[model samples]
Target chain A: MGHLSAPNDIEDLLRTLSPQVLGALVRRFDDFDICEDAVQEALLAAATQWPREGVPANPRGWLTVVASRRRTEMWRSESARRRREEAAFASAPADIELGAVLDDSLELLLLCCHPSLTPVSQVALTLRAVGGLTTAEIARALLVPEATVAQRISRAKQRIKASGARFRLPPEAERSECLAAVLHVLYLVFNEGSTASSGATLHRVDLIAEAIRLMRQLHDRLPEDGEVSGLLALMLLTDARRPARVSDDGALVPLAEQDRGLWDAQTIAEGAALITHTLATAPVGPYQLQAALAAVHDEAPRAEDTDWQQILGLYELVRTIAPGPMVTLNRIVAVAMVRGPDAGLRELATAERDPALTGNHRVDAVRAHLLEMSGDLPAARDHYRLAAQRTLSIPEQRYLAARATRLAPDDHA
Target chain B: MKYLILIYSNPQSREIWNSFSRDQRAAGLRDYAALHESMVASGELIVSEALADPSLAKRVTSHEGQALVTDGPYAEVKEYLAGFFLLECPSMERAIEQAARIPEAAFGLVEVRAIMALDGWDI
Candidate 1:
């Protein structure tokens, strides 16, 4: 534990150990709500003590013991008869073996993302129980009130308890579906972190890092699962481009215009290698295909070298497997690149008929890009302005408006 | 302390808003979004919302114990409350700073009113 020298290192270590400690407590006590609260107290105690007294010889064992003791004390504060039975049962000397406790993390994740809980609760609980973030940290990350986060987490634990979910993996029949839900939760967290929808905060970075760290832990446990590898690869590749995603003025820089030199090369290499390996070994999934797309964009030395033909083919696969409005819109952009803008516009006209695509700003943004490519400057400017007004994101609005202004005549201004 | 920042707009300003170009409208929305983002990040924002048009408002009155309802604009005031931000700030200056950041404050009045707690008033 001497490796935990810096304060930042200590924080990271605790975040990593938090789920394991909570998992062990719940497994022993069979009470998710009480166990979670006890583990949080233990964590707070450790957060304050470790730096002063030095890291304990066995951090996980130490936390498990402390949390178990707290659980007993909490039960003791109840009715005397209930306390006698609960306290005695809780204090029964169960070995807090480190190796066995490590396995509880995955089960904790599963229970946090149980089907009974809503998506919001799942996210809140997952960050609290698995990601080791405090309620305040989760509240700030999600931009909700601390009370709201607290309520969601408590509600989620109660739901899981009522569902009678065990402290182990779901049955074989439900394993894949449960895993998919877990993946979706992680995906949602990653996307929320990467985008920074409001466009002015550092809290998003913490979420991004936490999502990736949790994904890495999952990947480590299930090394043989390709989709897990694919999801992790996708996050790393997308996050790698973050450095070049925005300009100094806080405006979003489109992929084509971003400086390739500013991209994080090490992350790109790691992501590309992971995807390249997974794509070869595993059945194709949506996440793997998306990661493959990101790899394609990252591998090209310049925007001109972007293999659009291959991208179009991959989009075809994605649409065939899991079609959505955004997937269709992105496919149209690739269509414009490979074919001509007019060809893309024809497809866009039909795609816009879907009610899902109506009034979506990205559609207008795509239309503007195609119009510009087709030499219709006035029309492009109009669509850009319309798209700018339709978006709520400040950076996207500014970028679209700037594009519109750039195309306007000097006298028109 | 908690402060209520009221955003007011008059007919003249509404006309000006109607006359604005698409880019101007987008710019206004962007400024509002940025201000909201900053407030959220700074933990000053409790809640904020834009109200529907005043024309949609309904006025309710109790006349001789019977409830009566009618369309709004009971008085021909120069301005109306278009939106508001309920924020928790450390000081009046901080509240004022946030109020000034509201895009409407550039031309129209953005008032900052203190929210009185039960303990603040004497019997």
Candidate 2:
């Protein structure tokens, strides 16, 4: 094994090998905390040894071999007799195949994001296990206290172990439901990057890139899973416009005002191709249908060229499969664009009564826009204020506030 | 190989639970009984039982120099431990498979833990 020379190269190698080593240790120990600690120790050893020895030819394999030995040493140091017995058992075979173990890491990823755990825990654990991100990095990404993120990760690992959650993709019968949970976490990560639930910037490119990487991994593993392709398409299409999502001054830019030329044509093309391929496979699911709609919007050269009628039809299909208030609210906007603002406002009024949309900021923000367009300036102003108060993201709040300002009477101030 | 499965359920929703018809209760009981039989057949189940009502439960915790006793349930939460099962399996994967088979997991919660085989412990 040759030692790593360049510091930058070593850092990259460590980041890449972290997940593999963690996956192997987790498999052997069947305890995330112990596995994580062992992997960290192995990393520290690498940091000291690699600079002197140069980088290993297969860094992942080297890390696994070292970490496995360290775990055995720790177990033995804790108990002699048990260690002796376990050593004898361990000597029967050294079955630590790095490639197979890394493949199984996807199973671990899904297990971390299992619906059984809370959403916060799901995201935290996924970042830890899959992204190989430190707890502090996760804390920064989530905009929470580092200690809180640390505690959540610890509790989540403990619960997973105590629940005896298997680190494997669920059976085919349950794959759809299980994959939905994984996709939900990835989608939430993308949404956070795009709008930033609460952050100084409107978008975080790193988060979006990580999500795209994971989606690509899923697409590679499950080529036949249309929803996986659909999700990748959706992410690509949304991310294609990221270069135009904000102004040079870092203020939010709505899609209508965004520079169309700034959008990544390559991403848009790939997304459109994926959506078309998924649609060609008859009996497309909700996600694929939604991605198809996004593909259409991405193909449109301008806001006026948007096929709202087709978009509305896609939303109806999505509602049939996965009914939710967010989808309904989005459909209402499409209806407003095509039919009339009054019709859209009426739909929004009914949607506001939905338990799911009761406190949703986007619902109120859309209502404010429809009201403004319909000439009800006072009601629009009130709704905009309500939206601004409910929203957590500074950029989103600023946008709502600007809308409110436009509606406010000059004499009122 | 030894696993402990803890079942959690809402103990305070008498109105919702009591509304179940006799057939519903019987169906629920049958589901649980079938799970127990399956585990026993696989030679995984060691011991299992439903607990008494939460009102009869007692909790003992050591505080400072003295042991404190608690009345009724400990956490004052609607969801409380409803039952438990001890199983011996070939691997953690098998243990999780058995945990997922538990009827309580469908609508409630079932947590599984591997028994620590430290010195002085026996399974």
Top-scoring candidate (DockQ)? 1
Clashes of each: 0, 7
Query: What ranges in model 1 sit over 4 Å off?
Result: A1-4, A78-80, A83-87, A90-94, A197-199, A203-205, A409-413, B1-123
lDDT of 2 at A189: 75
Chain A TM value for model 2: 0.88
lDDT of 2 by residue, B8-116 (tens): 8775344455888999889877988898877654445657888887877778888897988888564566777878998756566778888898766766488988663
Specify the highest-lDDT model's number: 1
lDDT of 1 at A301: 91
Q: What is the C-alpha lDDT profile of model 2 across A1-413, one tens digit per residue? A: 67448886786678667877877777666656556666767888888889888888888878887777776666566567975757636653157766666576577777788776877678777877777667777767655456656766777777777888866668989877888888888887776556552234323236777788878877887888888888899999988987887677766677767888999999999999988988898468877877887788888899789899998988888888888877888899889988989999988888889887888778878989888879999988998999878764566777778878877757354
Tens-digit lDDT track of model 1 for A1-413: 43345667778888888999888877777788888888899999988988877778778788888888887677666545965776567566356556787878889989989998877778889999999999998888876678667767877787888998888888989887998889989987887676663344554437888889999999999877888999999999988988887678666687888899999999999999999999999888999999999999998999999999999999999999989998999999999999999999999999999999997778889999999999999999999999878765556777788889999957364
Candidate 1, residues B1-123, lDDT tens digits: the string is 578999988877888899999999999888889988777655567789998877788899999999899889734666889899988665678899889888778775699987632111000
Deviation in Å, model 1, residue A361 alpha carbon? 1.7
RMSD of 1: 13.9
